[model samples]
Target: MKTLKCPLCGNELTSIFRMTKTGSLKNKYGCLICGWETFELRKNENLAWKDAKEFISKFPPIMRSHQGDNLKLDFEDDVLTLIGKDTSRGKLYLQNCDGDVEIATPEDVEQWPWELEQKGGSNDI
Candidate 1:
């Protein structure tokens, strides 16, 4: 997987898991250097940029590691199309926007989008 850096700290972020929730798609994200956990969900094309920018900026870059330790990436807004990476195994790790982190295999990467809908991770907050 490609090295993903935190937009706030510019430090490498680590992928913890691909969060899946009901009514939404799976979200990719990581722990921030500080400690804050960040994640984003899928959104329509029109709301993608606006929601993305708003969502990304709302959370502070994390003043302290304890407060902000992680950032989650999303594909709903086409985040995966830009920063998502295929690990060649069976999953995909992605991070983008303000900042997020994840490591996944090729298979996971390929089906992440579909899995999102199947799992209904669109309702994540």
Candidate 2:
């Protein structure tokens, strides 16, 4: 099984179980670091897996430890392609339209995009 991650904050998601009123345990996933929680679903249920996978799929891999500025990466044809943008060659460039080009480091490549669609403004990058 693949590890689950929080879609908003990119943290490791932990599984939790709660007893429902019907006396059945429902499984849920939550991020301890960000307090992101998944909807309750019964164990051994396919929908639980589907919900977790689908929720995590919305956000791509982001630089979880970087504290610097979140560079605005460009999206291309429904894909977030950050390599060689703003007429930059050989390295990744920030697409902030500031005219002055800023080259991103290997670690910066994982930084979350500033323009990404977020829910509840939960992106703390």
In model 1, the runs with Cα more than 4 Å from the true position are 18-25, 36-38, 42-125
| Cα RMSD, model 2 | 11.6
Query: Native-vs-model 1 lDDT?
Result: 0.38
TM-score of candidate 1 versus the correct structure, residues matched by position: 0.24
Best by lDDT: 2
Residue-wise C-alpha lDDT for candidate 1, range 4-85, written one tens digit per residue: 3444554655544443555544434444666533444433333333343344445432211112222233333443432433
lDDT of 2 by residue, 60-113 (tens): 444221222344433321213343432223245443434454565444443354
TM-score of each: 0.24, 0.45
Q: Output the worst ten-in-a-row residue range by lDDT, candidate 1.
A: 61-70
Report every candidate's CA lDDT: 0.38, 0.52
- Give the CA lDDT, 0 to 100, for residue 1 in model 1: 25
Considering only N, C-alpha and C atoms within 3 Å, which residue pairs clash in candidate 2? 63-110
